[model samples]
Target: MRLDGARVLVAGATGVLGGALTAELAGRGARPALAGRDPARLARAAEAHPGAPTAVFDAYDPASCARAVHDAAAALGGLDAVVTAFGTVAFGRAAEVGDEVAEHLSAVNALAPAAFLRAALTVMGPGSVIAAFTGVVAEHPQAGMADYSASKAALSAWLRAVRREARGSGIRVLEARPGHLETGFADRPVAGTAPPLPPGGDPRRVVAALADAMEADAELLRTAPDGTPVVERRAR
Candidate 1:
């Protein structure tokens, strides 16, 4: 799982966290294929690292997810790592949240990543890694973000099961539960308005932590609110 010269595909490359990750991966000497819904943004992200490939796909669409993975793998010749940073947050009280918002959140946060991973495994081989950036809200629910929390929780559960199932295959699965980062993610809620909240951790620090975990083949990497390293769990 060495970042140097690793063939990686990063979904949601246009988003704040994903952008940081893509840049960091490039800086670490990894060949990254940037994928996202916006072709323009994906192109821009790829421009940061000359010769990097770009793929366009809607995260909520299973077919698109599969196609994106296939295209990225083809572009890279083979994939050593696939990182899913695609996510949307919805803020609302559980009781007042509409069904549409809940469904959208689930589709983007849970179902989309599942689809991407499934497709990625088809092309990925042993020694490859699949990492998902699921925030701390997945493990600890937060008020006003019930739907968002539930969606991430579902993804976390799926990742745990997949990790157990993939144990014998030599393919690593990592789940990162980083605390809030100053990526402006909270301000871009897909549904309800965001309430006032404290500034988050440094995005660069969070990306570096994830890169370190991938290099060490860790199972879980958790960071504190201030981007301080908290814990790195290895597969037992």
Candidate 2:
């Protein structure tokens, strides 16, 4: 899964983490096709890359997810890797969280990644990779963010199942459970107020760690709060 000259599609490419990832990919010699719901932001991100393609897609819509993957593959000539950095978070007690916010979190954080992974697999083959930026909350839940935590937990479970299914197929599935990063993610909650959280990891460092893991075809990449590589478990 060497990124050099690899054709990669980065969904949610306009976000804080996504933007950093796209830049890192380009620097590593990979061709990255940026995809997001906001056309203007996507355009801006694409412009920065100078000839990098962009696609607009609603993460909640299955058709749009599939189409975005298709467009990215077409734009890049082929798909060697796909990184789904799209997600939304809502902060509230489980009982206090409204159904609308809960549903949106499920759609964006869980189902969207599933849709993107399915679509990417359609265009990818042996030696290809699919990675998602899930969080440590998915594994260790905390108070006031049950809905957000559950959504990521669902994605983690699905990725584990998909990884088992894709075994021996040369398609690597990576789940990156990075600790909180100071990427203004807490400030952008879809609903409710985020509690004061501990200092977060560095977005750039997390992206670099993920890039290295993908190149080595590692399976699980867990990072510390400062974006240091804490654990890396390769497939047996």
Candidate 3:
């Protein structure tokens, strides 16, 4: 879809990928509203994109997610697109994965996206889209990543379900599963857990895929550095 004159809401605006996505959306002439967990970081990013809307939101909190979606839609006049790069990844062996780590990944990666999509659809009607970031681990599972892989797999499945439910609503749902993001996502610190970073991956190609698929109304599928794969899930 042509980004000009579009009103987009970007969740996880503070992260490396989210930061790049936000800048790309703004550069394309779309008004981007940032929704993040930290007000300070949101304010800093918002200042860079003057007059753009920003909201305090959490991926695990359904109420906060709903409020952020509605508030962003209202602030930007209407929500044309929503992109989520939120969630965490912990790289521990399946046998070593802890309850806290598993819960965090599940809540942020799976539950949050489902809840956010619900709120986004409530405000947006036709000609809108929802794109989220997933990882190739969902399909080609790894030995050292149980919680992370499962979370992304849940997201991919959930997006397929969303596409089915929103068939007549004119709202397209897409899941972007990129491999080995170079972004230091897994390098971050997490309380009560420790896991090394997965193989480094590219962020530009991933963001480009996200922009193109969401803009052009693609199906629920994953993207690789090599090219777009033919996933079995259907798109209406």
Candidate 4:
């Protein structure tokens, strides 16, 4: 879909990837409404875009997730696109992670984004788009990050099913599966310590490519072996 003058809501806009995406969208002439958990951070994020709307929602609360989408769509007059770029992670063996931590991961990483996107569907129409960020781990499960991988995988499956359902309606669903990025996300794990990891990819470049994919109405944004972002016109 064309982004020029498009009304887009970016949930988790206070996060690194989300913030970058919001800026990229705005730069491309799309109007972005920011949404995140913290009111202060949401306000600060909104400052960058003078008139961008802001909404607050808790990841664990499905109603709030739906509320955020409707609120942003209302403020934007109607949403042309919506994207989710926030989640929590836990690093540990499958058996070592506590039940609560595992539950949190499930809620934030999978259920929350689905909640937001499901709500987005109600307000969006044909030619509109909805996207969510799922890491490469979703497709390639990793050790010491079992729960995190599973959560992301759940989200990936959710998007795949939704894509099939929305096909006839002409609403595009994008799943961004970029590899590890230099966003310091690993440093702030909700539980356990991050194992030794290779250097991460450039976040700015990833977000730029994501914007391009959205404009092209592509279905997937993945990372090539060389760490370059690749937009796939088909979802597989």
Give me the candidate number with maximum lDDT: 4
TM-score of 4: 0.99
Per-residue alpha-carbon lDDT of candidate 3 for residues 1-236, written as tens digits (9 for 90 to 100): 57888999998889988988888888878899998999998898788799998998877679999898999998988899888878787765677777988899899888887777788888887988888888787787777777788888898888877788889888888777777666777666353244454455567656765676666777654544554443324442
lDDT of each: 0.87, 0.88, 0.79, 0.94
**What TM-score would you give candidate 2 relative to the actual structure?**
0.97
Which pairs clash (backbone N, Cα, C closer than 3 Å) in model 3? 1-215, 1-216, 180-201, 181-201, 182-201
How many clashes would you count in candidate 4? 0
lDDT of 4 by residue, 118-204 (tens): 999888999999999999999999999998999999999999999999999889999999998899999999999999988889999
lDDT score for candidate 1 against the true structure: 0.87
Q: What is the model-wide C-alpha lDDT for candidate 2?
A: 0.88
Overall local distance difference test of candidate 3 = 0.79
lDDT digits (tens) for residues 1-236 of candidate 1: 88999999999999988989988988899999988998887887777878888888886679998898898888889899999998988888999999999999999999998999988878888889999988889889999998899999999999899999898989999998888888888888887888887777888888888888888888997776566855476733
**Considering only N, C-alpha and C atoms within 3 Å, which residue pairs clash in candidate 2?**
none
Q: What digit string (tens of lDDT, one per residue) describes model 2 on residues 1-236?
A: 88999998999999998999999999999998999999988998888788887889886688898888898888888899999998988998899999999999999999988998998888899999999988888899879989899999999999999998898788999988888888999999999988988888788888888898898888887876556865475732
TM-scores, one per candidate: 0.96, 0.97, 0.89, 0.99
Q: Residue 74 lDDT in model 3?
A: 87
Q: By TM-score, is 1 or 3 better?
A: 1
Report the Cα RMSD per candidate.
1.4, 1.4, 2.8, 0.7
